[model samples]
Target: MTTTSEHTQSVATATPSRMLRYLPASALLIDAALMTLVGLVAIVGRRELDVFASSAQVEDQLVLAGPLMIVGWIATVALLGGYRRDVFGVGTDEYRRVLNASLLAAGVTGVVCYLARFDLSRGFFLLAYGLGVPSLILGRMALRRALHSARRRGLLRHRVLIAGSRAHIDEIARVLGREPWLGYEVIGALTPEYDLSEETATGVPVVGNADEATSLAKAYNADSIFFAGGAVGSSSQFRRAIWELEHESIQVVIAPSVTDISNERINIRPVGGLPLMHIEPPTWSDASRWGKRLFDLAGSLFLVLVFSPLFAFAALSVKLHDRGPVLFRQERIGKDGGRFACLKFRTMVVDAEARLNSLHEASGHSEGLFKMKDDPRITVPGRWLRRFSIDELPQLFNVVRGDMSLVGPRPPLLREVESYDVDTTRRLHVRPGMTGLWQVSGRSDLTWDEAIRLDLYYVDNWSMLQDISILTKTLGAVVSSRGAY
Candidate 1:
């Protein structure tokens, strides 16, 4: 059905389409080039060459060493699997690899130079390491943003064909649809014995049965095949299917039945020729807890000092608005069900609590948690303060006093805590936060279940990186004032 000229034209058109797959690799190469330029600038600015016998001699030596350093760095990154397809365009793993590779490159270069008796400027090397790593990270982050934007526009996504039962396919499809930044474009699904009219929950059409996955994947030009829980007939069948997919260079992702488990906690081990997944219990180690406390203390104290002027202004405004106390302190449940005085700027009338019973019917959040979009009790200054979350600034003092953290689950009122079931009480395992997954995600707009899920996710997967990400996102959340009444 194909003619020579037509086939050539089609090939030409397909060239650029194939090139898109290498975009991440190209970005990495560009990063390497930029890093090399930074190193060159550092070398020149430090007059690294002048430190040697003669400028000409040193220049000649540098001409050889400079390219070697760049090549070495790039090679180190490649060796560390920084250019792997899976690590690209998502997660902190790529950035971590880059940092590790850079450090290793620097150390290796230093050792090589010393052993070879080559005179090099220590300051220049130090400057290169300091500037290169951060600059590379920032560059990669910018590239990641660009990739995410492209993905949002329905570009640069992996063509995925889900192979599973109807329920399993639907579940994976829903998750993939929600997280577009993950870059999986579900073309269709190959379920086990699906009817011709069947479609996934997210409207992905059923193309074929599970046994026909490979043929369907090829027909659709799928880049990956996702196997949800109970997708294949048996373990042997699943293993064979994975081998076949790998042979065809298609990625295979297995979504085990385990839900809400962080990757860091899961380890794949082989025992007696069987691949077993070992899940580590959530970290409640003293070292981790102490580290969190130190971070909270340092971060909260710094924030308090930085916002002291705003604090003074807020206090004055509240005092001027009403002849009542500026600080509003309420008893809230904290870690291990302990009670603490949670402080905020007085946002409502002094007798606001006295009218709570009268407004309960109208509040709409009558089921344990209380949230009203518009309350008549709020003062004018308090409304503005709450809108930008300035009222919560007082909680930084709580953080400094060891009652809270910079990031964790939201602190619950004593009444709300009283209604919490056994599972919900797990939130009290760690200190509450000034800003948390709940605060940055949706704040007051989130339903109770959504809020609980996010809080549980944070508790299960608490890390310094996750905390930093939440804090960074909190600034945007505050600025937008979405769901902040």
Candidate 2:
């Protein structure tokens, strides 16, 4: 019988990596095409000439410019990682790369013009750079939408196999479930510890053991196999599996055991015989505290100025719907065990807090946490306000008053603060937020454990960049209304 190692070796070598096959080539071609069209327009527009101009001299100049533009496009894209598989059709990373590539191209053209003693019109380069960056970004945006739509219809997807302990494999499944646009359809998982029966784990079926992992992956025609943590017994086993998979044309992804390692801080060095991953723990200092405070102050001030009209509108809406108070100010825990009144629009009735005790037994949310999804106290206008998160607009005042921030952990109610275990209190290490990791992540859908973990992650990794990213995502999440109640 053919050994599992032999079977896998056949697959990996035989199947070319999809990175080279799909996204890169397509991206390069689209970019080159875009550059070519832009170059033609720039040449004609700068010369103040028309297509098929009566003058042969204009046509000759255009012809010469075309090849130079093509060369510049190729050189720029290569230098800027425009064809990297990892960046294709996802996130702002792709657009950022495109902009970097265009800028690099301009630099190359600038240097070449100086060296060659050609009096190239500066207007041509300026026009191309100005138009090309936005054009390329727009093109990628359109293509990304098309690709995402295709993924939803079940096309352009990869079949993947995961190898790990049951828990880690399940974690991978949950992650993949959230990113349908990534186009990973997990085929199954392989575990050495248990038979992991044929039944599906997290919607992915368990295929077989480690010894038979390669064969099973091939049998399913898997495009990629992920070796999750705690699955492979030894380095030899991993090497043997990689060698075997080489013949079967399957790619491999080794999941690291480390958690809480940000992409910014993790570096990999292939030493002697091992790929050693070097992770530097986040360095925190007093400077970070002052910087964060400054950011919070400036951001809060800007938001207050921009949203002043919205605040007036919200106050008017609340007053017209229910002749109750416009603002709801409740005492909540803040940084260093401080007390502050968190502000929000009065979405519930004036007597909502008084009625809470009577309806305690029927409360649909966490008992220690105060959440009432379908509370009878909510007015008709409150539902619309809550759905779009307009009700939380008053928290800008809290931010202005130094009681809250644009991004941070949520401030628990006085009763909820009292219910906290020692570990849960870590959330209070920073000032509370108008919208937090919990709010943008899953809000009411998050379990208490998940909520705490995310909060801690934010505290440990707090940076102005992270805060801005979270705040931007918060706007999108609020608009999409995912997991919002």
Candidate 3:
């Protein structure tokens, strides 16, 4: 055990660990390489360039100027915090920043070249920036994917020490446990001073009590410290804990009780020198539903036009396979207990519905949402259609006809709706969607409870932006066919 005094000393003298020490260098090099490549492409695409000062040769001028441009672009991105660990982690902010920085770099280059009378080719400059910014964004996305993969494998993780009530601490732990790619490796936890549990209910070991938090964090070399509910007795204790750990190279995060809320709904307001967090109520109203309906009308029509060929192909394939109707319309529970005929390409035998109960008994599926990995009723064309979600193409008609939205909860069957308890019925508040959070996040692989939670969340916190994002992700999900059976 590290003594309190030793921990105090270490806290005062702690420095950044070797973990991810080369990240900044790596980012710098990546940006430079992308910029250099774009510059060379611009030169070859537009060989006619103005002479630099007394240098009449375009190649000679570029040989000196290209590296300088690359260095400037990298410097601008660094200045704008594009390479920050937190910013680059979980959102589009990283890509946005890289784009902003690149555009700013382009503007600065143009301004400087004009002011200094450096005769630069307009075509070359335009080509360089037009290609460079998007290329840079793509590079960052690739880097982020690689980083996320590394994090999933337990590499480049932040060693975290949690402090809070056992309930809150374990809740936080469980969330981290689910999202391994977030790179938070829980080392141990600190509970309230009144309790003396060996570990949290979630099995996260208790290293110390709340009062020992600062010392324990230092002792463990924790790169990140989380303070949840019951972590500190009062505001003063929390302040003191913060003050003591201020010298250490550690990130202090307060995550006692927020979950499943989008960042768009959260804001901070300072009153009387105290920062109070405000959470907006969820969006759920008839007016909002209409707005979403309009969106669905437009989106579904666009999709139908674009994928009309696929529609014809799938219909013919399914019809040829079984000589059954190409379109399979099943009555699904829609908004507020309304019934709608949900459409799909016929992907199952004519007797698929009649066999549901027998299949359920055979599979021992006691869940509300029935799923089987290999159902015997699926026809040959149906199997291929389900793989890439081609079976769902006809739902575009559902969206256009107002029977569903472009994005909302998956239309449930009457039997499924009948099994809903009070809370589960909340999913009916919004129109059923052709694809939704349920589609992008695991699809058929999701548990009944998980699917319910996602649908309820979508119904409660409906937003146009969220719908658009889900639609974008749906394409990728369909292509990857993850969790699709």
Candidate 4:
């Protein structure tokens, strides 16, 4: 019933919306405002607020210098690519640039003051930067949160055209699909010249052949083009394709066949005209060392102390609900096949474990994962506890005892561990976590295989930064309760 012209128009309209133009302008305005506010706060803290008055006869030269510093700081951020559209969302590159810019601006200001004999207050300088840098980073984080929320609602996503073999195209598409916050919307696939198909195995629509990547990309009004593995036969052809797309505003991303590798593990090197990808070996060994353990212990200790009141309340609630035990302890497999008693606030009836087999048989997935939504066994208070993950708070004790980490693979039950394949067994390299990639990703909503995949990926690519990021994302995930019981 639909004509080709109407279809084409609808498809083309999938390109970026007004958010494409608003994001950069918003970042600039926010940065300027934040820096100005920090400068004012610094001035007031140092009792140099009089510098703003025209009649103030201050020898500190704070009047002209303060405004110049704020302006220069903002300019420095823009000069260092902080305002670029590419760094606007989804990574720490923007925050890192802002930090670098702040440092550069401060150094220049110090140098200029010394060379010109301008009396700049040292206290004000330290106070301003110390507050300003963090404030700017927080501002960017808040803006990024807004961008992520919009993308999750299917707004402002990049229209990505993937050019590759079917298998590689699907792989890239899967990753992009999993992380909606990354905002890559796959418009269609550009297959290798040999095979012409209407769609991929995963049902991603096929638009054209690989050789016509540039043309098809433009036709779709793609915001980005991903050249997945096998898009071209040789280096020269790849180079030609890149050159063809240079005139368009479309971003070109080369997606290697590899999956589940973090950016930290991948290093691109220029080797005699070729970009050689160097992959660092897994960080699991290093992560299992004392540094991470020390952090886990201290962090858990702090959490336990701070949440003592909440802990008491949870315990009391469990006790009052049906007079059941306050704590539920289950033996779980931990690092390198070791067993530990994982703890949680009791959120189910006393005989809940006895009902598992029947539920499993009824659900038909009787072997690997055992989850039942609206589970009748969960107490009324238990539902609320599970929804917000207050039940998992007792895992801090497991962390204290060194059986778990603040961030690592999910702790598996004895039965679950029995079924793990060789690849999945690698998750034992580090201790299990109170919260992990699996916990924050989808929790009970994830497929058994998907949960294992995320756990294995965490085991093989562990880093303190990755751990910290997962921990931060965990807060948002808990607040949203995306995939809780």
Candidate 5:
């Protein structure tokens, strides 16, 4: 006979509140309505151009298209997990899924139109696709901001229970603290060996042990239980805790030991009855090197061509403002401790280096790196240029010169490298990047440890996809202008 614990129900399994149920439905309705409106507008816009004129444009065909588009919108949302309650106010994942669904829907519509021999205007379809993608993402972003406002106002919040030792639970608490927009308030924690003196991490009460955790959850009405990485005594202890909590209908989230692992590198497979994790390291070989180099060269050339006007404008502005050289070249440590001339549009006074000696004490010495948050030597135009990263555009020339890759760790100053311990020296293994993990994340706001961790993580998990992601994020980072001196 199966034990009572083994036959128990799931936690957070209770029916969602009426408000919770309605919110997602409301979001889906809004999504569908926006898609239909955008699609109709696109169709009208296309018909104005001669490329979309057809015989059916008079009346009957126009009337029939509305219902078909609505149906398509609904189907797209369903396929894309739009109405899913969980992802409603979450991160970009929900929006990404919706965008993918729209693309798929557009593809299917194309195929069906082709198969049915219906004369659909290609221009109209393209307009709809173009509008639908941005509309979906923008709509979601707007909704997310609204939902975040509601959460801050204390309206739609999730009460959570965390399980594990103090150290593990503390990590979970800090993560939750960083994502208050997610609206998860820790109700309590469950630990096998409870210590009252150190009972709570992040001020959430330590309620009970594994056996009594279910009652504590019920009392707190927690939406879910987060299992932080820790031993659960025995297999039976783990099984028993899960069984007891299941009857209360709670969703259980097991936090794995893995952190800072790139999404591209991890794949899960089922082996017999157990789940196996497969981690494929980033491709870094002779062929990969060649491909990456080729990609960097081609992309740098394309960007240089496209942004030629902006580049010229920046150079002109610098020249007009100051009587010095437009380009700034510094000897910085590159890959494998090689020194390269890192180029930038000069943003500081020519005497900036000369004045550095007087300001050296102002730049604090921490981990052998000195940083001056407010250097007096920065020229007026230089301040604005550095803030928006306009000064860094000239790095494209460095990429062309084979001295730098488009993406990698930030180049360390020669003085900075001299101060590195054995571990920090690992960053020199790869070519220094124009913008990187730390630059996109926090830049100067990051402490030395966090900065090193980001660099090490990049070195450990570097990939073409990851590089692309960093480059994309760098665009936003430049716009935000955070942590720039």
Candidate 6:
């Protein structure tokens, strides 16, 4: 087996390219340019072709306000941590920051104009605010997609060295490895002396013990050092390790023991100069819950209207192909273990369930789940419908009926729910979804454990932004049909 040093050297040779290093700066510059362009356009549009003929005082005010607005917007984003490296390619935090910064910039500009008695055109101000914020958000999204593409190809990622007990390091490595878009490439691990092997359970090489973590991290040229739960024996020791790494300009991250918690629910308080992390209980606030319900109702209604033609086509095709029912409705476990009939376009032969046992040996799915790459029970039209996820279109009605949401954990069949362990049953905490994180991530191809993990993560971290992101990706996943049966 290769020694830990050799493994570290091999990984260090694969460091991300110089172009990757400048991504944040490039994004910042592009945002600045976009803001300036939007501001100039707003000014010119408001003044029309007579911009130059405007009073000298007005022109001077416009010039001064334009630069100040641009500078202030950029500064606000910076202060809000929009340009942080960790926020570059994953989640909605970056977009939220950009929005916050834009609003702050607009509010400050309005206050300044009021104090100075400069009559800034309301039309111009509104136009600039409206256009610039969306443009900046879109630009960031575009950059994030580019970065994700690079990460998938192993081109842009931080070389991460994990420090912790064997079990924690293994868990961390497994989770990080599954999310390439998060852009952490684990180079190796540092564990306590009890571990003999030079490799983690997940096969991330063990480079050193915690005592030698700083040196090993440097040797590996790691971009970040992640301390898994109980990596050091004490908080003071962990602080010392962080201090040592900071002197070397290395980034340090500590993974809390908790899983599936959203950052929005976490607060850090400093007491007696010691930082304490407090986790707020998950919000089941009526307003938030009802807000989601309202969104689901509206979205489902809109989709049902828009896809009425496709739904008719599917129904006609299913009926003509096999003279079977046009829709498939099966009892599924919903929120709080309530039984509801989940709807789908019929995508199987009339006796699909009766034939299920016969095909079990060839199905290749684990217990409590059923999937087959080329299930013979699927009719020709049904296969086509499944490939494009058209069969799921009828779930919109379920959404409208309040039995499901546009996004949430997958609705589990009654049998599947019966087999769910205590931990897995947490999936029933929220209404099932028409499409969700699992649908976008891998759909039918994911292993039971992987699917359950994703479902639990979604359950704990549900947000409007996350739901939108999943829905947007679901279209791509359907088109690709990589994991569809």
Task: Report how far off residue 166 is in candidate 6 (Å).
Answer: 0.7
Candidate 4: segments with Cα more than 4 A from true spot? 1-9, 12-22, 48-63, 309-313, 479-481
- Give one digit per residue, the lDDT tens place, for model 4 in 1-485: 76444545677666565468678889999999998888778877766544332333333566788778888998999899999999987768999999999999989998998999776777677788989989999999999999999899998888888998999999999999988999888888888878877788987877889899888888888888899988889888989999998998878998998888888888999999888999999888987899998999999999999999999998888898798789999999999999999999989999999998888778786566577889999998899999999999999999999999999888888898898788888988889998899888889889888888898898878888888989999999999998999
- Badly placed stretches (over 4 Å) of model 6 are 1-5, 12-20, 47-69, 91-93, 108-122, 283-295, 400-402
Candidate 5's residue-wise lDDT over 440-470, tens digit each?
9888877787888788778778888778999
lDDT of 3 by residue, 1-485 (tens): 86544543554455434567667677777888888888888877766543233334446667767777888888889888987867755877888888889989999999988998887777677889999998888888788788789898878888888899999998899889878888888878888878888777877777788888777877777889999988888899889988988988788999949877777778989999888999998775642456777877887889899999988898889889878888888899988899988888989999888999898888888757677888899899988899999998888888788888888888988988888899889888878888899999999988888888898888777788888899899999999999877
lDDT by residue (1-485, candidate 6, tens digit) is 87766876797666544465688797899899999889778877767734334344435666778788888899999999988877788778899999998899899999988998887777678878989999999999889889889888888788888888888988888778888888888888888877777787677888788867788877777888889875888888887887787788577888867767878878999999887999976643331388899999999999989999998999999999979899998999888999999999899989999988878866555575788777788999998999999999998999888888899888999889888899898788899998888899899889888889889878777778888889899989999997898
TM for candidate 4 is: 0.90
Give the range where candidate 4 is weakest over 10 consecutive residues by summed lDDT: 50-59
Q: What TM-score does structure 3 among the candidates reach?
A: 0.89
Better of 3 and 4 by TM-score: 4
Per-residue accuracy of model 2 over 1-485 as CA lDDT, tens digit each? 75445544554444323443576777777777887788767766767734333433434544676577677776777677777666765667788877887778778778877898665666566767777788888888877888788777767777777888777888877767666877887756788755545534564556678667788876767788888876788999888888887877677888765665466667899999788998766533321376777887888889878989988898898998878889898888888788988888888888998988778866555545666567698888788889889888778778777887778887888878887888777678788887777888888778777787788777766677778888888998899887766
lDDT of 6: 0.84
Q: What order do you get sorting by TM-score, best first? A: 4, 3, 6, 1, 2, 5
Candidate 5 minimal-lDDT segment of 10 residues: 3-12
lDDT rank order: 4, 6, 3, 1, 5, 2
Winner by TM-score: 4
